[model samples]
Target: MKKRTRINVLLAEQPIGETVVVKGWVKSFRNNQFISLNDGSCFDSLQIVVDRDDVEEKILKQITPGAALGVKGKLIESRGKGQSVEIDAEDVIVYGPANPETYPLQPKKHSKEFLREIAHLRFRTNTFGAIFRIRHAISYAIHQFFNEQKFYYLHTPIITASDAEGAGEMFRVTTLDLDNTPKTEDGKIDFKKDFFERETHLTVSGQLEAELGALALGQVYTFGPTFRAENSNTSRHLAEFWMVEPEVAFADLEENMDLAEKMLKYIITYTLVNCSQDLQFLNDQLEKEESQKPKNERSAMSLLDRLQFCVDYDFARITYTEAIDILKKSKPNKKKKFNYIIEEWGADLQSEHERYLVEKHFKKPVILYDYPKNIKAFYMKVNEDGKTVRAMDILFPGIGEIIGGSQREENIDILLDRMKEMNIPEEELYWYLDIRKYGSCPHSGYGLGFERMVQFVTGMGNIRDVIPFPRTPGNAAF
Candidate 1:
């Protein structure tokens, strides 16, 4: 058997004159003499200079844009303006050759919409490659931050019977045929013969499970896929999106905010430090596409740089009542015009309100807690005031609500009462309530959309473009 090639052993700068062997799919053939080969090594492909005499005629002819090759070469300096070190190929072995005609990706540019269709091959593109690399790095950074802080990594169940958030956004899992669905004598459908012996669906958030574990472990986090059946065809919504929710026991709203802010800052910082090449490629891709790009976004090399500035700077923290006051005041004397006019209370905040507080008024990240009781989650702790609950949503400059968290209603009476009020069946959440009954702690957690982070970091316009295999409304093509 042939020995496996040690890919990504040395970076271009590390060994300028030393020989290296890399196996990767060819990104592009820059010229007849130059081939951009990225061997799963780094975010950006290393440019390899190929001489006409050095490579075989048949071998050289077959090296297409997406062809996979194992190349043994010496790292040399490049005359190219965009990059630094280039490789001088000694031997080129073709492992896989992607047909250029049928290959979804080529040298030409493609739209985010176009890329979403060929989601399988989207990662080979520069934009998605960078975005995915950042996604991976960001995820690891989440684990790193929490793990180092001695937080237990919790794996919340995927198939759950309870709706943690009473948002009416769950995709029910059934084994019944729609053509001949089972029904009871009375007009009710029978769920007993269905999957799991009862009604069940995908979990929207792991906050409840995380809470149970956190109460025992003190600090716990759940990083997994969350499903929402809402047919939202926007740049931000995905039918199935990964969520990173960390629940802390015996922690207040202030402490929760601090942990979240620190975690965000850490993730950004880690990605910047770890994946520099990937980020630069993403930045260039964004600049090429967007003409009227946000000035703040252009300057950021890594998301962490922005987060570091965020943590160092004071975040704008105000009550829902205070925000209402500010919004109402703005109506009388408008300093700047807002797209969505905000001059009210009792209603849910529009994107305009969130943007105003985070992007305009604060000029920094704003943690908007103490939301109206009617608009917020039922499990959230009722604030000192009668009408509002201690539910906070972290809003960033670019994205409106990146993180949504709240102090859980630890009091069993209030929780059960709220559940009853919301019409959530008590029988379904027997295990969840057991956590409250056995040993309850003042726990809190936040759900962060993973694809949203990818969008934020890579500056991608669509959420579908960021995820590898996006499960959108009626589009699940492999």
Candidate 2:
């Protein structure tokens, strides 16, 4: 077997006049001579010059768009316009032939919605190739940033007995027959016969388990898939998505906000420097996308500018009450333009309100804290006024609420009271309560939705487009 060089390496090194073996899917075949090939190593494709007279007719006929091919060729300076180097094919081998008539991806642009329906083959397109490559870079940057900060990477259970978010939107995991479930004497369906001998569901968050690790290890983070049985069919809602949850011991809400800000800046800066080529491609793509929209609806800044703005400046920090006040005075609210109007305090601010604070009000990333206790989770620390909690949400320009976290309620009695007030059963989360009982210290953490970050970085409009296979309300197709 001959060694094959990656297209990215060959393009970068430009080993002129050297015989090399390259294998990839054909991006395009022009006039039975020029072939554009890409192997997913990078965004750019290599141009192959094939002499129609030298190559057999059968071999030439098989080199269609989307066909897999191996070519033994000599690399040389290109006479073409886009690429600096081209390959002169000495021999051609077809690994697989894609019929041009039936192949979904023809040599033409396809809509993102259409490509999503054929996600398995969408990776071959230039847009998705750049998006997924950037996705990998962002994931790497996340781990690298945490490791440098001396945080331990902890793996939490996907199927958990406790409801971390207490939202009751979890996917139930059961092995019992649903058609004829066993019932207790009182007539309620029995969960004792289930796989775990008790009720369990896919975790909505890993903060509860991560807190245990943080207490033991000082700092810990969990990056894993989280599930929610939400029936929302909007572009931003996904039934299953990735989450990055970091927990720290002996940290207050202020320190928690600082960590979240630092981590986000580090990762975004890393992607900007390391994945420059892919980011540039996506930036131009976003520019083209925005050009089609009306001037009022288009983004205020370019994609690259938006990312740089996030890294270059300190995020504007304000309280949720302050944000509500600004929204009430804003023209949109006064004119009744917002879908959910902000009439008064203690109201749960929707995405429109969040975006207004970030994009229109501050014109940069904003961090809103000290939310009303009634709107936040029971685990958040209650303030001295007793009306608000030490909760914080980091909002980005385009994507609202990129991160949500807080200083946890370390007082066992307060935790119990809050849980009871929310009607959450105490027995199910006894272990969580135990942590508060035994030598508990103030700890803080936040959960960043991984897909939302990717969407912000890549300037993708839909959350489904950021994840490889989106699990939504009625659509779970690959």
Tell me, by TM-score, which candidate is best: 2
User: lDDT tens digits, residues 393-462, model 2?
Assistant: 9999778989999999999999999999999999999989999998899999999999999999999989
Q: Which 10 residues in a row give candidate 1 its minimum summed lDDT?
A: 1-10
Candidate 2 collision pairs: none
lDDT of each: 0.79, 0.93
What TM-score against the true fold does each predicted structure earn?
0.91, 0.99
lDDT of 1 by residue, 69-121 (tens): 88888877777776677778888899888887788888888888888778778
Worst 10 residues of 2 by lDDT: 469-478
Model 2, position 119, has a per-residue lDDT of: 93
CA deviation > 4 Å runs, candidate 1 = 1-8, 16-19, 77-84, 287-308, 331-340
